[model samples]
Each structure stands twice: as C-alpha cells, then as structure tokens.
Target: MAWKFRRRVKVIPGVHLNFSKSGISTSIGVKGASVTLGSSGAYLNTSIPGLGIYNTVVRPG
Candidate 1:
C-alpha cells in the first residue's frame, strides 16, 4: 500500500507547514528571509541588501 500524505495551511503570511508518511516539514518566508525544517534536517536561506544569498543546513549526528 502507498503512504498517504497530508498538508496543513496557515493564515499567517510567509509561513507554510506540511506532513507526510515520511516525515514533517515547515517553511517560512518573510522580508527577504526564508527557513525550512524537515526530516532531512534544518535549512536556512536568506538574502541581505548587499551580502547576497546565504544558505545553511543542520543535520542530526
């Protein structure tokens, strides 16, 4: 049998969350900023006025 997936929507601006048979994840974006968290790990993405884009990741050991 195939696993079913589910998703939840929020009214908040620049925010999203989802869930599935594999795992759960979330994403947020606001004011040129973004962040994501999931089973793979945690990720952060952002851009500054002049610093350009920045990306980072964190995983379990």
Candidate 2:
C-alpha cells in the first residue's frame, strides 16, 4: 500500500504556510519529505531521512 501525509509547519517568516509530506509518489516508495511555501515561491528543500534522497523530484525517476 502507498501512504501519504500532510502537515502545515513554519515554511517562512510571515508570508507563507508549509505543506509538508512524505511518501507522495506512485513509482517509488521513498521516505523523502518536501517543504513548500504558501502558493508560489522558491522551495526550501526535499529531504529523505535515512536513505538521503534530497533533490527536486518534479518528475518521477
């Protein structure tokens, strides 16, 4: 089964709200997390816990 999560944390100082998540993919069951800003802006990071897959995965690999 595929699992997904969503949480709103401190994305930025006062202009944004974060939508964080893990395991949001269809091909690979990766443990990476993404921290994106409110609507449209540069992203903070994409980090995996143990495996360490930190890169912009705009399209699946």
Candidate 3:
C-alpha cells in the first residue's frame, strides 16, 4: 500500500493553498468552479457541489 499526504488551507473566502508530498498548489474560485495551478501544470476544475460530479481540464502553458 502507498500512503499520501495532502493539506488544504484557506487563504480567504475563495482562495486556498494546497500542500502535498509532491509540491504546493493554489486554488481560486467558488465551489462549483475553480482553477488550480501547481508544479505539474495548470488545471481547470469544475464540479456540481452536491452531486459529486467533477471534471478537470489541463490548461496549456
């Protein structure tokens, strides 16, 4: 089995900082829509708050 570590801290109402074993990332937006930029790449994250449906798109740099 593999273990992973991740932590999210809210910087403000719609902003968050994400920390993980791999690296750090930042997320900005409301519940259903947000953008995450990290060491791997930039991603567009979207989801239905209550339905548990979500999608992620990688943004070309």
Best-matching candidate per TM-score: 3
Clashing pairs in 2: none
Off by over 4 Å in 2: 1-31, 38-40, 57-61
Per-residue lDDT of 29 in model 1: 78
Q: List TM-score per model, in order.
A: 0.46, 0.23, 0.91
Model 1 ranges off by over 4 Å: 1-11, 18-24, 48-61
Ranking by TM-score: 3, 1, 2
Pairs clashing in candidate 1?
Answer: none
Write the residue-wise lDDT of candidate 3 on 1-61 in tens digits: 9999999999999999999999999999999999999988899999999999999999765
What would the per-residue lDDT of candidate 2 be over residues 1-61, giving only the tens digit for each residue? 9776665444344333434463221222224544443333434455767876677634223
- Judged by whole-model lDDT over C-alpha atoms, candidate 2 comes out at 0.42
Model 2 CA RMSD to the hidden true structure, in angstroms = 14.2
Model 2 per-residue lDDT at 37: 30
